[model samples]
Target chain A: MNESAPNPGDRIPPDELIDALFDGELSPRARREVLGAVRHDARAGADLERTARVLAALRAPPEAPDLTDRILHSADHRRRFVPGRLRRMTKLARAGVVVLALVVMLGVAAGRRAWPEATTLADEQTPLADVNEAFRDDAAAGVGAIRSSVHQVRMSFQAISTADPCVARLEIEAAPPHARMLTAGFVTNPFGIEDERADAPASIRCGAPRIGAGPTIWVGSNPLDPARPAAPDDTP
Target chain B: MLRSEEHKLIREAARGDQEAAASIIRHHQQSLYAYMLRMSGRPDVAEDIVQEAFVRVLTNLDRFDFRYRFSTWLFTIARRLYLNAIAKHRPAYDTDMVGSWKSSAASPEAPVEADEQQEARRDTLQAALLTLPPDQREVVILFHQHDWPIALIARHLDMPEGTVKSHLHRGRKRLRTHIEVAPSSGDALAESLA
Candidate 1:
């Protein structure tokens, strides 16, 4: 076969032909041709032998009983849940996203109600900063005189503009007198200015020299009312 | 080609028959498990991967394309699962095949010294197989161990026939080199090649 090697004319490379021999792709006649050549040629013989031994050495371990059982058990587990559980999980995820979106929307609405945009006080010429200082001074003076009776005061700030140097007013209301050092706190608008109006009841008895210490001071019951009626001598 | 009986079992298993499913698992589990064990070099991981592969195969049985061999499709699914496991960076299953080989050498059942010697030789061959690149290792394994034709391997791996041939040739050459330089009694394995 090697002596009269009919050059099949580049149709089949020797390496490819030999590889096909191992793969059993060649016909019986071709198989005999390659097997005979491999037997006679030293290099070709080594190639076939090496391939065979390496293949032999890679023997797989025998299958165990437990491994088969585990596989069957796992298949059973998937049969129980794969389709149904996937659809259910997808539905739960969509519901969760909708709930999160609604919570965010409600949060924005509640924030707007709690802190409205600023509104101007009667005297627009006084900067809100100066009004804040005056309110602080009044509270400080009243703090000593009313310390025995007044326990806590709620100060609300209303701003007329969102930017700095905007107009605003601080109205102070005191809770019934308590033991601690006034347990002081302040309320500021979203603009960070400490000013706004809130109605105090006459029963609570709020008193400061600048803010009227009378029943008419608490006449208007609506906390949301915009009318901040000034006193007889202090009318703006 | 699956015999008529095996084909019938496959059809029954696909139709939610539990007993047929068990029979199907019994038929294919050995070769599948062995292939995974040799590929990953970890018995524990091989077991896990084989189980997961079967789960996927059974759950999607309706999608099985009948033109191909069942083992080919099964191994293809198993290969993909193995690759995904590697991609996820799951911890390597301990390389305890060698450790077990050591303990098995002293087993009371193997009372003959030749049995111990054969175990040692088998352990060396296994170690060499594990050291080959995974691609080369798998081709050599499917070709040499499973007797899969090169064409079938190309189909299973979704690669060109030329590429599969290249891998097989390079893999055999490398395995020869690996076995030659292996740590234990290299002469014994080298003689096998000769």
Candidate 2:
């Protein structure tokens, strides 16, 4: 305690000092000093008393209804979407991928016909029609014995008459037995690579159609092609 | 200083332990509810905010830094939720209310209600508290109602000690002014203050 600390006999302390004392900010010596002053001075005593009264009344509210159950329930519900538990969804997605891949293999093995020798088309609007026409004609040739075990379908193209760099769009369509046609498209820089293969598992997994209709692919100019006039390359 | 066991409970609660979550709620619910009741001036609203705060606290436990008190983090989240609720729906602080819905902690004598005078005084103080700006009201509520130390309050509000002290001082000044002039056609003054 400070020797100079005021006694209870002293007058009321300043308001800031009283506030600090109430707030528990005063040091021990200062607190003792303020307490001593507040004890004897009637006004200071009332002020301190009033402040304490207010603080106590704040606690008078009855206990709130227990919320632990509700909170826990909400949390448990939300945990499903939390990233940490996303592995559950990942497991489901993986199962779906496996099923889709199986469907693709079955479809490719059961319905694939010996397609007419591969057709190469130049990047032109008219050749795009020719490409589609060629795919239809080949599918019309009818199905044959499926020999290959490997399920990869490779589409190779070498652009011959393009002035600027160009890309080719290849759409692989499979008509599964009773379901709608499933189609997947790929864009290729024909100048850079001779061919691009769309894996059976991935291209087939794009849609879950039945597994009976054979797969036919139509190769054309980049659908986003600006101007096209050259005839398609017809090499086998 | 909190017990080591309480910290353990926090860690366990963060790991999805239901018992730990219950313990944490039981430990802080009273103080938390009272604080919200004082801040929001409604028992229903206070309860809802507390429930919402607990959900947020439990869900975000991984992000909670152990450097600070758990109660501080809990209250910080509760405060933000209440503010957001207020922003969406400004609640009415009405008159002649009973139960736990008072903005300012009333003078203790209000409970006993020895006479009509004491009751009126309590009402006036509540009205005065409503007149305070939210910043000042929050400081006052945290300091007086919750017995929070100035330093802890500074940390909770992310403000300097001087600022917290300033808000407390101004808040107390306003309360004093309201209580002193509550009688004799002071409704206008109270409205202007609000």
Candidate 3:
């Protein structure tokens, strides 16, 4: 490097002076004299030249920020706002959806309340009659309805073991002239002879229970059908 | 003069204005970014470092002393960040890399065009400087770039003036060898030596 250059900031010479030389930091008189020697001195000349070039380049700007582009990409926003009115709109929409859902659920609840008795008629009655009925009674009161006609019908029986096989509570419902009927009685298609002879009662007929302040109406039955069906007696 | 108004904005920001905080970034970003990029030799890394430094400065604006120039303070922050980055990404410099740089690839007399061309010149210099040992490169840059008195360079670097000189002499000598052999770098090197 700069061999024997006053041993660089020492008692031998001021450290600051040598540093000044390296940085071209000297005042005019000193700079001229120091530079003169360096020029004459082959080694010092080359040293100063390279030193100057490096310095000049360093003084130039470093790569200008490509950061703006990258920061925007990373943060996913070119600009940030105050989170103002848009936030209010989002909250309003979410509240509206929740309210709509609640209203629909409430409507369904009201409908179920109005028609309570009709909802569960299927479960209380086990296998109902497979009646071969050719009768239609358009009655004012009904709980639930499933009607099918057969020429000959058979219903396998599971007797209660103690009660009469022919007896069940019968509910006959009609319009204003008659109030609803709630009665317990015996029903017999006796003899187990596999007959469809009694079409007069129009197969196994039923109606709603008695009307009351409480909201409910249903009919109950004990099943009795033979294993098979034979010809109807009313055919003639 | 005020590092382009960031110090003023920082004061306003510290006084509880959120908008002031934004103003500080806008004002100081370009110059600070330029400084960091020159200091750190990687363009991509330099970008990240500058943004982070600005954010940090904004957050800690209250801690700044009133006496010092804001650019000096900002630069000190930039330098510290640059050093930390160098440590984290401490690359093993293969000596072969020093060969390709070969001083000035662009002719000193080449017609200057875009501002980016000037930037490329600095980046090239930064790359070459990184080829030097850290001690020599720092002294060399401080000396030539600032042309500061040795006392200032010494204070700035926190090294003794003697050490600054040693680094200067040795760094300049090493650089001279490359420049003499460098193509198109003729006059700048010649003028410096003269």
> lDDT per prediction?
0.62, 0.61, 0.50
Candidate 3 on A127-149: residue-level lDDT in tens?
33322121223331232221111
Q: What lDDT tens digits, residue by residue, belong to model 1 across residues A38-154?
A: 776666676666656656666544443355566667777777433445655766999999999999999877877776553223555568888999999999988886754442232
TM-score of chain B of each: 0.83, 0.76, 0.66
List, residue by residue over A81-168, the lDDT tens digit for candidate 2: 2343454576688999999999998776555444323333345678789899999877765332121111222321222122211221
What would the per-residue lDDT of candidate 1 be over residues B65-169, giving only the tens digit for each residue?
777778888899999988987777545532455555332224567667666556555666677776677787788789878889778888888889888888887
Backbone clash numbers for all candidates listed: 10, 5, 3
Alpha-carbon TM-score of each model against the true structure: 0.52, 0.52, 0.45
lDDT of 2 at B90: 68
Give the per-residue lDDT of model 3 (tens digit) for B80-154.
887887777666222223233222324567665533354344434555566568778766665566455678767
* lDDT (10s digit) by residue, model 2, range B11-97: 766766677777888888878987876676677788899988888888887788887888899999999998888887764534333
CAPRI band for model 3 = incorrect
DockQ ranking from best candidate downward: 1, 2, 3
Measured by TM-score, how close is model 2 to the native structure?
Answer: 0.52
